[model samples]
Target: MRATLIEVAPRDGFQPIAPFIPTNEKVAFVEAAHAAGLRRIEIGSFVNPKAVPQLRDTAEVLRRTAGLEGLDAQVLVPNARGVALALEAGARHIAYVVSASEAHNRSNVRRDVASSIAEYGEIVSGLPAGVRLRLNLATSFDCPFDGRMAEGLVLSRLEALLAHHEDVEVGLCDTTGRADPDHVFSLASACLARFGEWTRWVFHGHDTYGLGLANVAAAWRAGITAFDAAFGGLGGCPFAPGATGNVATEDVAWMFARMGVNTGVDLDALVRLAARAASLPGAAPGGRVRAALLGACATT
Candidate 1:
């Protein structure tokens, strides 16, 4: 099996941290991700600077990586203003988020389900040519406030989004890590059965309960080919309580490589990059392969 892993450390990993990472260091991390064979990366978000201070320099970070060959940068946009900023930064890939839980969506984006879907319709209709927009269904499996979500409810939301745009890219986020392997597989299968094979689906899972890798396997088994992972497993949602970092990029890469699946990522380089990410302030690397390889190097 082959899959494409989208690095989300720069954006999702660092959002909840207090100390700000230097812009140069952020760019270096992105460069290292490219070197590790990650062609697609979520570098930063275009939300209000005051809300996510760590990503205030999103434009600068995007600017620094503009010339990297074969690298595609995707930035999260919360609204029309965010869309404007991302466009100004020359970003070609833009992702808009809407939680499956109505309460969660209201809290995260300050809009109800109806309003949020309206906003998505506006963004998709007004987007310039050659730019791609992705809709992320946060809390697809479960919500902190609403508990477990039914797969049918998630599909309904996707249907609403698809009503406005055709052939859209959608990411199913296990927001607080509440989803088990069975839940992940069932939801993924349900979504695919209803949406057909042409709908591009990406799985984003958190490691809050240590089931991130297990959930990833379930999603893969259900025919999902794209995944989102943060370097070192550094990620957390500000709106969701007890939410932890995403499944580590190196961890997922290591698992796939050992399973005889090709991910096109160099494990050695990813391990080195994970080390650097772990050294960053407020960042932790949760991937076992990185620690094991570092330990091996120290003993020799």
Candidate 2:
């Protein structure tokens, strides 16, 4: 089966926590992930230090991992400045996040989603030779302030972004972990039917409901393959309260491995990476392999 795994442990995994994750340690995590055969990583993010102190040294983190072999590093860009910072830091690929909810977008970025989308287009306009871009439409499954998101609404916004973007990938986010298997199948099916040709369809599912793996299977069944997972399930949304972990990278790899799909990722090495991941300052340790590895270390 065709499958591509985008690791988000570095950026999404450490950002929501309280303490500072040393840049060296972050670099180690990235290095270890590469050894485990993970090629694509959302390595860091460009945002205000005051907002996400854990990733305050984004520039340093990216610089530290500048020469890793067999790894593709990416970061989350909130706007044009973030994009510029990413470009300056030698990132060839970046992911832009704009919440699907207007209120969430304003509360998070001080602008509505439309404004952010336009800004993403502007960021694209000024792109250099080889850098690539992907946009994450967060809250695609559901929104907090706004209840029950309509599929039509998500597609409409998606259509708008696609109209403006020619070479961008779109990752539909299950921000709060409220999505189920049926939901994933329907959404992925519709998304592939409509946008698969023009853009790559990536899914960001959370383990909040213990269905993150199940949802991944749903997307796979729907003929969608690209996914974003956290190292040992490291990250969570800062805006969504009670939302704790992303699907663990090791767990997802294991799942696909057993199903005869190729993720080009090594589960045991990734499980070892989970040990270092759990040590990241204030990291909540939500993924299964991460907790298990750390627990074993404690028992030993």
Candidate 3:
């Protein structure tokens, strides 16, 4: 089995940290991720600095790392302004995020779900030639404010978003990390069946409940070929109380390796990078592979 693991440590992983990570360090991490055979990476987001001060220097980071060979550097854009800033920074791949739950959407972007969908249309119409778009339905399975999202609501929102554009990638995000494996599998299966041919599918999960990897496996069984993970599991949604970091990239790579699946990531190199990320001051890191690997070496 072959899978594509889109590294999100630079963007999702670093976003929640209170202290600003130096721009140079952010570029280095992206370079290291490329060296480790990760072709796609979410380097950062172009959002209001006041909202996410951690990613305020996204333009500079994007400029510095966008030229890395074979690197499909992606940036998150929440609105037309974000899209403008990202494109100004020479980003060709943009991930637009909107929550499935109305309440969560309001908290996340200060807009209702319908308003976001309208904005999605405007964004698609305004994107320049050759730019790629990836739609991330945050809270697709569960919402921090609304609790477990009804499958119908998720499907309807997805259908509405896809109606705007078809040539794009879609991510069903477990924003609060409270989603179960059964929910992940069922939703993934449903989305794939309904809109499988319309766009590419990706799974974004978190380890808050110790079900991150289990949820990943469940998505894979439902035929999801691509996933999003943060190295050392450094992430959390500021708006989602009690949510933890994303599923660790190293852990995902380890799990795939053991299952005879090829993720094309150099585990040793990834572990080294994860260690550096975990050591960052003020970073709340999670995940077991790094510690488990260190322990195994200690015993030997």
The best candidate by TM-score is 3
Candidate 3 global lDDT: 0.93
Task: Give lDDT tens digits, candidate 3, residues 197-257.
Answer: 8699999999999999999999999999999999999999988889999999999999999
Report the candidate with higher TM-score, 1 versus 3: 3
lDDT-wise, the better of 2 and 3 is: 3
Question: Which tens-of-lDDT digit does each residue in 20-94 have in candidate 2?
Answer: 777787888888888888889888899988888888888887888878886778899888888878887888888
lDDT of 1 at 273: 88
Every model's TM-score = 0.97, 0.94, 0.98
The candidate that achieves the highest lDDT relative to the unseen native structure = 3
- lDDT, candidate 2, residue 116? 89
Q: Pairing residues by index, what is the TM-score of model 1?
A: 0.97
Clashing pairs in 3: none
Give the poorly placed runs of model 1, Cα more than 4 Å off: none
TM-score for predicted model 3 compared with the true structure: 0.98
By TM-score, how accurate is candidate 2?
A: 0.94
The 0-to-1 C-alpha lDDT of every candidate, in the order given, reads 0.91, 0.83, 0.93
